[model samples]
Target chain A: GDSVTQTEGLVTLTKGLPVMLNCTYQTTYSPFLFWYVQHLNEAPKLLLKSSTDNKRTEHQGFYATLHKSSSSFHLQKSSVQLSDSALYFCALSELGSFNKLTFGAGTRLAVCP
Target chain B: GGIITQTPKFLIGQEGQKLTLKCQQNFNHDTMYWYRQDSGKGLRLIYYSITENDLQKGDLSEGYDASREKKSSFSLTVTSAQKNEMAVFLCASSISQFSNERLFFGHGTKLSVL
Candidate 1:
């Protein structure tokens, strides 16, 4: 019973534009993917993590790719700033259930300059 | 390289009041967490502790109440408090409970129920 699907609640962009923040997940085992970033009030960090399926993990400049046959991990950015706005979460880590996390339903990245 | 202290950044309760939220960590972590941030319903896990005293009941533990005795503290209690409720209470730490290990947050505690 692990689930995470972010369909973007809001994502207004401008400033350089090239952004994608859609993530999907649902696990029974062996799946660890994360991307958390919450600014404005601050407290959610760690903006990139993967389990190495398609391999493409990055940080700061943002990037993600853990396609495990389409379970998806999507979170990309080629250019977009204005602090990149914030509030983007997509998490799921339930293999042995220790680092317990399963979140999604957050995608408010408004970066309009 | 360590910090996670959440203590009353802002809180004001009234409806049946019984609120408490405190957490501290110096990174000597084993495990400690209490998350509940709503506004799109992103993070939700109400309790966790894996070392000194150990207690776990995440998935938004019902009315909520937790304590960890030692291991750098971890407390959360809100027995009753609901009426115009607002939420934001996060405190985390990890160096165990491994699945990849990466959680170190604490910059929240904005609860208001009046």
Candidate 2:
């Protein structure tokens, strides 16, 4: 069985501050990691993803590096904004299993001005 | 460039009633999925289809039925709605064979069982 764990249940930060959401996964095959963000009243959308360990993948000012050694793919942002307030979900899939996605309990991020 | 549309943005049904949610994707993806999201909880997979006429049961498939009649449409039916059941059902699609491909989600159908 594959699983993903996100330790943070809620993350609050001021505008312009850094952001980091921890994510870790367990799987029997090669791992593919992903980040999905859901805004208020909106469907979740992809933020970033990567399968190659040690390589940092980024999109829309958000970045995540998949570290297989630690079985982690932590999402980070240099600066946070009010628009970034949303629920972030960390997901994972086995190397060849694209239909099966294991997602962590999301972290809700609130950016205060 | 593509969109996933889920019908009946909100549904209210009585206990033991049969309710159906429909999802249509224009992405031309080979795989479509149904996920359930409860308040303050994570998304749980209910069902997925790898292609037209192919169905796969996910971690939480009991009491649910799914159909992939065409590549662009996928439907989920609740065999028996439970009392006090309230959750959002999300429909998503993605290109098959891409290990890390992102999933495109629809607006989601919020369900309430009385």
Candidate 3:
């Protein structure tokens, strides 16, 4: 079984401030980590994903490195924007367990201008 | 790019009533899934299908039934709706059940139980 944890249920940051959304996962098998973002009234879309250990994968100004040793893939952005206000989800999928995907309780990020 | 379509953006049902949610995908994916999203509860898997006519129960499958009527369509049924089950139901599809493919979700169907 695989599970993901997102420490914060909500994160409020001022525009232009750097932000980090914590994410950690648990799995006995090799895992794939992903970050999905959902804007208000929209479907959730993939933001970033990686299975390579210790390597950072980035998209849309956000980046996260997969740290297998710590089982974490924290999402970070050097500068936040008002448009960045949305719900972020961390997910996990085991290598061979193809169809099994687990998502964490989302963190709602509010970027204030 | 293919799109996942979920019918009836909003669903309202009386307690104990049976409600069905429909999903269709043009991605020609080999697997489809249904997940329930609640405030602070994340996405809870309800059911999944690896191929046409196949169905697999997920962590939160109780009181639910699923049908993979065709490769492009997957439907979920709430055996008996409850107020506690009022939430959004998301339909997703992946390339195949054998690949570590990412899921593409549809605009979820928000459900309400009266």
DockQ of each: 0.31, 0.65, 0.73
Residue-level lDDT tens digits of model 1 in A1-113: 88898987999989898999999998879998889898888889888888889989888888999988889999999998999798989888965568898889789999998
Give residue B84's lDDT in candidate 2 (0 to 100): 97
Question: Whole-model Cα lDDT per candidate?
Answer: 0.90, 0.93, 0.92
For model 3, how does the per-residue alpha-carbon lDDT over B1-114 read when each residue is reduced to its tens digit? 999999989999999999999999999999999999999979999999999999999999999999998999999999999875579999999988853578899999999998
Q: For residues A49-78, could you state the per-residue lDDT of candidate 3 as single tens digits? A: 899999988898999999999999999999
Candidate 1: list runs displaced more than 4 Å.
A1-14, A19-29, A34-52, A55-63, A67-74, A78-85, A96-99, A102-110, B1-11, B14-16, B19-35, B38-44, B47-56, B59-77, B80-110
Which of the two, 1 or 3, has more TM-score? 3
Q: For residues A29-57, what per-residue lDDT tens digits would candidate 2 score against the true structure?
A: 99988899999999999999888879988
Q: Ten-residue segment with the worst summed lDDT in candidate 2 chain A?
A: A93-102
Off by over 4 Å in 2: none
Q: Give the best candidate by DockQ.
A: 3
Give the lowest summed-lDDT range of ten residues in model 3 chain B: B94-103
Error of 3 at A11 (Å): 0.3
Clashing residue pairs in all predictions, respectively, total 0, 0, 0
lDDT of 1 by residue, B1-114 (tens): 999989999999999899999999998998998999989879998899989899999988999999999999899999999998999999898999987888989998999998
Clashing pairs in 3: none
